[model samples]
Target: MRAASKKRGIEVTSISRPIKPSDFHDFDLILAMDRQNYEDILNSFERWRRKEPLPDSAPNKVKLMCSYCKHHTESEVPDPYYGGPQGFEKVSSMMY
Candidate 1:
């Protein structure tokens, strides 16, 4: 992930981990890059909520990150894995 960010001139010094159920309780907001990711995160939280007690407001915590971006042209941010460097740079700029 750091390498990907570096390619787009974004500094990423922190390491990342697999998403966990506890993330729903840890972060105030959880954002996903795309619809698939949005659903996946929600599903994980749903599974956790099924086994544990969560606040009634917990279901509203997860959302699409792009929904917060005003300048982005697309509703879903494109995954740059199969695209060129420009795609990565575009996503980086949109993020900034």
Candidate 2:
């Protein structure tokens, strides 16, 4: 996917380490794959917000990854772990 994105003139960032609040300043967006992570992101941001209040432009930057996902329109992605591949595939079909 990274290769494909590059071929199409898109930039791909892959995170291989723990994310810290300071990292947000370098990226245009920070999308959490699910709500749990979203809350984690929010909580961390809040900690930063206490020190540096976010500008009005901030809210538009932080978002759940599902918000941009073509598949899950309901604001949350279903857990596919217990449901197996079929569940994950369902989401894949909707997305692609």
Measured by lDDT, the strongest candidate is 1
Please list all clashing residue pairs in model 2, or write none if there are none.
none
Global lDDT for candidate 2? 0.63
Best by TM-score: 1
State the RMSD for candidate 2: 5.4
Model 2 Cα shift for residue 32 (angstroms): 2.0
lDDT of 2 by residue, 51-95 (tens): 875654554567876778764466766665555666655544434
Pairs of residues clashing in candidate 1? none
The models' CA-based lDDT, in order, is: 0.78, 0.63
Q: TM-score of the candidate numbered 2?
A: 0.55
